[model samples]
Target: MKKYIPLLFGDTRSIVGVGLRACPKRATTIGSCPYVRMRSLKYSIWVLIMGLMTFFTTPASAALDIEITRGVVRSIPIAIVPFDVNNPNNPNDIARIISNDLNHSGQFQVMPQSRLPQQPHDADAVSADLWKTLGLDDLVIGSATLTDNGQTKADMTLLDLFHSNQSTPTVLMRQSYTVANSQTRALAHHISDIIYEKLTGEKGVFSTRLAYVTVEPLPNNPRHKRYSLMISDVDGHNAKPLLTSTQPIMSPDWSPDGRSVAYVSFETKLPQIFTSDVATGQRRLISSFAGINGAPSFSPDSRSLAVALSMGRTNPNIYIIDLGSGRLTQLTDDAAINTEPSWAPDGQSLLFTSDRGGAPQIYSIDLAGRQVHRVTYLGAYNASAMYLPGSSTKISLLHRDDRGFNIAIYDLQSGTMQTLTQGGYIESPSPAPNGRMIVYSTNVGGRRMLGMVSSNGQVNIRLPEVSGDAQAPAWSPY
Candidate 1:
């Protein structure tokens, strides 16, 4: 008899087994039947011990397991040489930032800086043979120089080692930028954009920003929690509070131009829509309708806002408020709850969450047609639908299944739904400006933190704040 045991890890699968054969009835003195039985028993015991060890050694709830549900089969291989800086105390590690951005995308594997045989500041100095010896597909080298005008001048060159035919590597891209000392980080992100686009043929979102809500316990007032609206780089750096309130702040949406944000705040003991300019620290109340005023989303044109307002009704309806005139036009007049309105990339339609069908589901309403059509049917619960960047055919949203609320993407063209996360509690999915990644909130050991997932359900990342809870991430447009 033969017994087989299967082991599974990611997409990898293997089997371990031992065959037990009856000992020969007539055995020579050199090879006894008793010896055969003892050997078979030892093999069986060894297999059992190994299987138990594997089962116990595997982390059941590892963060990387988030992609076990679905992950990119292949990630691009690239190297980022340490950027040559005129001063050791420059305080800006541009190459590291670029490397982190590409790594976080889960689409590229960056070679470690220590593994490089030499540091090259430009294409002229890059040793094609040395890097090629390491078998890297791509290589990036750059330099940052301090200018007499107190600004920084940065130059980056990307080399395609795969295309190199001679001692010199092929130049895939080369770019130069001048920015103030304070904006050096932004310059690095722009360089990442150039590298990502040249390699993936899709726009990169490394230069984009993220807007999220953070909550912390107030000292001397244990009963009250301070809610803050935070703006930061996509990697969770340079976090600054846009507004802080004792009350809650919810549903943040970035303006089309990425200069301002619209969100629902409870500053006046009631939910109201407010828009704040990122540069000027200016804020304006956009909606204070009689009933609920929530889920404010900016129109693509930036001239109007699509919001959910109850208007003293039993259920909230979709409304479009002209930012200039404050004119309000109701888009949905249903008695059922219609909220969480997000605009299409074209701004001609809106996708919102509604409970008209007895289940919370997503629906679409064309501004001109005024016809509401159901968009989700996979699960009994679906909400928070937003269009992926540079895509109208797909949207990332919250979905509920047996596990709980998780992030999932719905293909409008294929009518197929695929989940991207496995957290027990997950919500508020905001896609990156380039539409290749998503950031959402998840419950991690009773505390709320941010998580990111690639659009293809690969590359899961967690962003946990050191002192507070982060939720409702809204990615800025490039």
Candidate 2:
């Protein structure tokens, strides 16, 4: 009998089994799973218009393996009832957004209140029976009260719907804060953390942000092109355009503190690297290197950046740029095309795509310049690579396997590649803040749009209203 162990990696699936166990009987079934899941995400790519592409999420690699081995699906289903708000104050309610975020991870299937069959609006009316009947494993309930001073306080408690009694078991998690607090958005994320840990034994990424690029075509004027740098809530609702220009913008990366973004902007008539404050919109040029100054990535500390610059004029090499002292540290000296540099969670190494292997594949280079290892070898073209933060045991990338370009991941220890996405030209695959899922861009019926796939690459869902060719999505750190 053939033996096989499927490894979960960046894209949906990249089977690296050496004649492994006949590809497991259930692998194919899991790859085409029909389970419902959700997550917010984006995809990045070189500025190109003529050849419209769609993202093809893979079969396995990142999806849950259920029929056979309990390969462990990472997400948990959650249900958040609309808070019993006596007075509606905030424009965006906390409970509703929190539910959206959890479902957006692609890990948890957020059950709509209407689907729960019967759910009491108040704590007094809530019972475990009603929740269990709806197939909801977890629940979050909250309410807000306003004081005479105009400040409203929100009190929320999470219920272990699986274990709670009719009396409403002890609060699994609770927090009180003023309504409309700038940090209120994070409350849902915190709740995500509690439910995530309780279910999948992992942290939550509800507080993450989705960064994507929009190319608004000028229908009337053929020469006018509106390329925009936009960020949206993971659910694709709060879309706000940040920077706009007639030229193209490549590689938008988030800072560790979530205050700034570094990207390659051609608004100056030439390609250059610039850092901008997300809130204040303050912009600064970091590298105007004569050759190519593009693909800037902020380190975990937010003090330095890893950018692809042709300073040495050798090749598009990687360099560490210090924001404070303007110090430049070269990371790779190879003559191969080394672009798309991504910093590891610990900041010890960086992942980038290089054609040194005849085809563009993913490679990791240590900061000390001692070790250089290839991360992707199965595909002829594996340009973009992203590091999933939930655990260091796995790494993700976008690889092509019959389908255009999709997401794949590599098991560092086992050296196995598995496909994560199914179909379409997916790019800029970024892990959710929790590491359970990835968000990328794929053309929906020929129009590029944002989509999400589970970390194991099983569940796939596209964002609503994000259409007409979108690209280069980055997930913010929670």
Leading candidate by lDDT = 1
lDDT of 2 by residue, 389-455 (tens): 8678688788887888888887887988888777657888887776777878876567777777777
**For model 2, what is the error of residue 46's alpha carbon versus the real structure, in angstroms, after optimal superposition?**
44
Report the Cα lDDT for residue 291, model 2: 83
Candidate 1 structure lDDT: 0.78
By summed lDDT, the worst window of 10 consecutive residues in model 2 runs over 42-51
Q: After superposition, how far is residue 14 of candidate 2 from its true place, in Å?
A: 19
The residue pairs found clashing in candidate 1 are: none
List, residue by residue over 89-122, the lDDT tens digit for candidate 1: 2335788778778877766656556556788786
Number of clashing pairs per prediction, in order:
0, 49
- Model 2 spans > 4 angstroms off: 1-78, 84-93, 133-136, 145-152, 164-170, 181-201, 219-222, 312-314
Q: TM-scores across all candidates?
A: 0.83, 0.77
- Model 1 segments more than 4 A misplaced: 1-73, 85-91, 147-149, 464-466
So what's the TM-score on candidate 1?
0.83
lDDT of 1 at 476: 92
